[model samples]
Target: MVPWSLWEKLTTAPWLSINAAGQFVQWFNHLLMLIPFGAVIAVALGISLIRRRWWSAVAAVVIPMVAYSLNIWELFIEQLGWWLLIWLISFALCRTATHYLMLSTTCLKIANRCQFFWPLYVGLCSIVIFHPSWLVGVASALIALIPTFICQRLRLFAQLPSKPLEQAQMLGANKAQRMQWVAKRWLTPRLQNWRARTLQQSLLYCAFAGMIGLPGLGQHFYQGLSQGQHAMVGQTILTLLLLQLLLWSIDHAHKEVL
Candidate 1:
């Protein structure tokens, strides 16, 4: 016999009934959860400045700022599937070297020269510290980093250059030839690798977010499981699966110019 948890999730599709109180509660949860994102930005900036690396500061601080300013933040909070898509696009478009640099400087263990532990550094510096909840910021950065390092080490993915076509021109290729080469070789292979890494990282982020009680799909899945909200559980599972399929199909279709 199937376990009750498994049976409920698979068999009991929950109806989207109108729950005004639930709606309000959801909104409030979003607000509370997102307040930390600002701290995430601030700390990233603070770290960059302390390290005297303005480029890192700009990437760590600026991109998320732009995403939030453009209301992409809200989309992620309200719709997990869309949020995953947003992350996918960002990952696909970034320069390979730049993304690796950011990950190394901010998240990975590449630089830890401080004799003091990070907590003590925070204390001695008298800079606003992690408020006990600050681990969320560290964890979020790490969540993005682990796969990035793995990808770099294995060359599992390559980033799209800001101007891949220009390189062909520098080699004296005409416009037509340059375009053909890019489509046939660089663009497609890079896209394929990017898609594979994106899917894997997205899954990692989803799982980590749930473990840490972060907002969006992870939080939703966690709550549903805890409350025995069978319908919500089914919804989250299907949403993640559909996202994976979409990613795979998009990569497949763009195989020529990925």
Candidate 2:
């Protein structure tokens, strides 16, 4: 069994300082990591909103807001406003992209087939890129996510009954018109379930990217393990478990709402 003094030293040593301000600053820096972490869910929520999944959107927004309310609220109120703006921008961008993709069969086909070798692509990029930067992390995460996104979209597209497209075509609807009509009538509704699942999967991928230098809990956890900092490792594990619980609650709430 560990002595109380030793446990205290283990837990507090990382933040121990003679100056109070310095200790506070260290804590603040650690909490700042939540911004990007929360942004993942925010971006996912934005995409879900674009796909017209209102319930999942609500869950996504509320879960993070509640989960990090204590630590993140005091970190930067103004930055929260910036995040909201970012969410709005993402919403507009996704909506426009979806509109354009629906209008162009060539673009849709390209998107479907472009990332066929995503696993190889991710591995090659990770191997070649030795330096760790936010750009590298973002690029890696996006590379891994794009294929999953396309597959989810295609799966939804397949489940769509052919009757609506056929009916639209029968009425002399052009290719674009049929595509748009089917998208609105069928694809959007079915997208809610998959969007929620995708958001969960995206969180996992984002966390995994931390091992490759993505900032946040995962990165800190990896560093702690490498440095043999038991306290830091334990803290990160606890934080990650809390995060997982929050996500599960959000997912459960989303299911009930549906």
Candidate 3:
């Protein structure tokens, strides 16, 4: 009779082959789905940058959305962390921009800003007080955006005048202006920082989750290693590396914009 270990391996070989084939098919389907959407987004961004025409903007947006009927991009992004990365990058960049504003305020206030500190602190602290949920997160994001958009609209965040402008003339001194400034300076920066840090944190979380048998790329990678799918594992690793590079490029572009 064949050795027990050899027999088990032989028995499972076909199953292993099937699973690998499935994974390859999934990856290819994902690429096919995204390539068109990616192309359209790229084109729209170009036209928007160039012609600045609303119609082009709408066309750029409306045409590629035809992909949504296929829903492949959604599936790929759901598994791939692309959406998460975008959220995090946006949050990080905003937070970084706010840091300078906060620092400036700290010096300028010289005890004056302390009056508003408690409310601001309380508001921000509340976000971290509970376990995160999608509903709560979305509400919080909208609340944050209200002030952010206001600040951008009013140009409340342009650099302070070189010479000390009169406090009375400060654009952001009014209640509305202050709210806008605070939201722009604090909210986006805070969110962006949270996003970037959380994403990096998730690599660890996903690994730990795998150790506990949670399902994800981590679990799949683990299974691949156990079953000796060296090529499959290698491809997964390569895919992860490519994703990181893509995220890095996006961050670099956003940074340049900031």
RMSD of each: 19.4, 13.0, 17.0
> What TM-score should be assigned to candidate 3?
0.31
lDDT of 1 at 140: 43
Output the worst ten-in-a-row residue range by lDDT, candidate 1: 108-117
TM values, all candidates: 0.30, 0.40, 0.31
Candidate 3 lDDT tens digits, 161-194: 2222344346435555554545555454534443
lDDT per residue as tens, model 1, 128-206: 2323333443454454455445544334213333345667778787877665555456444444545334434433344
> Candidate 2: TM-score?
0.40
Q: lDDT per model, in order?
A: 0.46, 0.52, 0.43
- Candidate 1 residues lying further than 4 Å off, grouped into runs, are 1-81, 88-150, 156-214, 255-258
lDDT of 2 by residue, 1-258 (tens): 999999989767754556765889877876665666566566557656666666666766665565465343332232333333444454454446556766787876664454344333543454445333444455555666664667567665645545477777778878876776666566555455553333334333433333333234445555677799987666554544444444444444443233
Query: What's each prediction's clash count?
Result: 1, 0, 6
**Which structure among the candidates has the greatest lDDT?**
2
The candidate that wins on TM-score is 2
